[model samples]
Target: MQNSFEYGSTRVKPQRFGDWVIEEITVSEDEAKFFNMRQAFQGKHSEMITAGKFLRLMQVSTGYTVMSNTPMELKSNEIAFKNARGSVLIAGLGMGMILEAMLTKSEVTHIRIIEADMAIIQYVGNFFKDDPRVEIIHGDIHEYEPASDEQYDYIWIDIWDDIDVRNIEQMAELNERFSNHCINMNLWSMDLLGCEPEDYYKIAM
Candidate 1:
């Protein structure tokens, strides 16, 4: 990953929403052995990571669904992380991973985050509550719309539980709402589909 953050910066009690809980998770060495290298960043890496381990920050839902700061998640968001600049708006605050990553870039002047789950904002969002340049909102990405005069340099949509070809429809609806609100916007996993973030516009069209 291109940016690193100190997980210890924030001290808060564990928070949960339904079956999802915002907390740290330790992955065993045996679990790391089966990692798909294609999904993780290979160089420099991020902070708090060891050779056989991943970052501890994570949000776990029922059935062991995880949203974490693991290398795999970093790799998936890397392109957007590098391309993001100026005022950025990110949907889905998963363990505040991408939100914290954006803090490392001086070029990013402001960050606005929207997450559907209030528990996530109460939990993961607490870490950034003191940052003047960041705003955390509780809202649904599918129904939320930006203010009329507000615009962002970049926008990232990452609300899905997982990447699926069926996500294209929702992405298109997002494009319709945000196309003019941002100079460039992206949906996560477009790169995994063998398309650049910019290509997302074309792919959806």
Candidate 2:
């Protein structure tokens, strides 16, 4: 790990993984690099996991929802809390920071996390095994099926692996699933104040 900088409401810092940083929470860098660093960490799976264990240990569950970091306060402070008691769906379940925050709120009833990696899920869930509100789903988001009677208030999508965006129909279906959803669909790369690519960091709320 290295010294950190401020990015929106969170602080960003370089970790062990290639050109990766953490904002608001510390991300895990303990495992072997499983995929391309350029696409996964900064691009899609930004919310799946974080570096710090304390943050994960403190979270109510191992589920999370994250979007753009530039407008951090906008998304964080303006979450839809009305008529939300049944369940909330999250695309990525990183270090469990966002879900941890959701649990702090009085309205959120449960969380269903959809993650492609089971190993990552196990790492986080091993700590919060006692929490009943968190449910981990080990599968791809494209294969997910929503119940006919189910409608979620919030759906956050942040993918770490490369996706086939040529399928517009699939994207549309994802859009229709959540009443409220946020996606960080762009890569935020920067090298500021003598910082390397690893030192660059931004949150894409």
Candidate 3:
């Protein structure tokens, strides 16, 4: 953990796993170093690395979502879930911070979390074992099939391996399929800084 920097609306911190310092900014096109770093940190599963108030989800593989439970990130999702009630479906479970924030709202009755990684589910599940409102389902959001009778009042999709245009478009497509039309549907957007797609590539390069 290191001092934090302001990245768009969120406070970004550098996460050190061995020799690799995982910064908030997008890495260069050459991902070999990051891949190797992932290998080094792979065996350390569900180890919640903290810097200030943020929680870092370190994984063993590359090309997966890189998330930090920053206050700005948590606040945005919390505000979105303010009026949320009945049933809410969350597509990605990072560190369970968002889920915890949602629980603070009395309107929210049930929360179903879909996570692709069982390790993450196991790790995060420990924090909410006593809560009856939370349900963890191990499955990819793309392959997840809700019960025929189930309907969510809010659908939030935050799965992002990278914040590129293609990934953003994929999230949009998934939201269209799974989101309840009558209520609110939210997808994590990388356009937080109002930068164009080309600008992101420029920064990464």
Candidate 4:
């Protein structure tokens, strides 16, 4: 690790691999970041707030914010980590942190992670090169499909950047595609946040 590895809610320094960069490190709480955290981590996570510093992984090409290891994000992925077992199909390859967490579960026999970005698999894939259980494939989640007999025990989708009602539609679309392959399919925060399309609309109004 270049500086410090942050996963499941912790932060330190920024690291980079190819076009992918992880940053937003600070020794003290930045006021703007603090406010953003307060807005996002309100209600239950309000008290757990410590500092505003967090790791941000993003792609410089399209200015697409990849993912973070914030507490909210870590909390969101807990459901998938708990229920993951057997053959698993995961969408997205952010910072390779989730894969690090998934590798801890002995019940998880194999994981086939499908990422749309090729730059990620080229660089981030090096992190998991030693792990035979993980197979990172290059494909778009929307267009990718399994073989005729291909099936999985669990399917986890965290393809979106943040928690939004728009993600629900994406999840539904993915569900329609991969539902038959697994006993359970979990979308990153679709269940963890416990919000729906209606909730987001109400918030907007």
Best by TM-score: 4
The alpha-carbon deviation from the true structure for residue 16 of candidate 3, after best TM-score superposition, in angstroms, is: 13
Model 2 global lDDT (CA atoms, 0 to 1): 0.43
lDDT of 2 by residue, 122-145 (tens): 664454556687788898887877
Q: Which stretches of candidate 1 lie over 4 Å from their true place?
A: 1-18, 23-30, 35-51, 55-61, 194-199, 202-205
- Candidates, ranked, lDDT: 4, 1, 3, 2
Clashes counted in candidate 3 amount to 0
**Which regions of candidate 3 fall more than 4 Å away from where they truly are?**
1-53, 61-65, 75-79, 180-182, 190-205
Residue-level lDDT of model 3, residues 1-205, one tens digit each, is: 1134232122223444432233453334345345445645864222223234334556645534366655445544554456456778888876666776677667788988888877666666667878899998889988876666677777777787444567755754565566434266666653442435342221111
Error of 3 at 89 (Å): 0.5
CA RMSD for every model?
5.6, 13.2, 12.0, 6.8
Off by over 4 Å in 2: 1-86, 160-171, 177-205
What is candidate 1's local distance difference test score? 0.68
lDDT (Cα, 0-100) at 94 in candidate 1: 73
| lDDT assessment of candidate 4 | 0.71
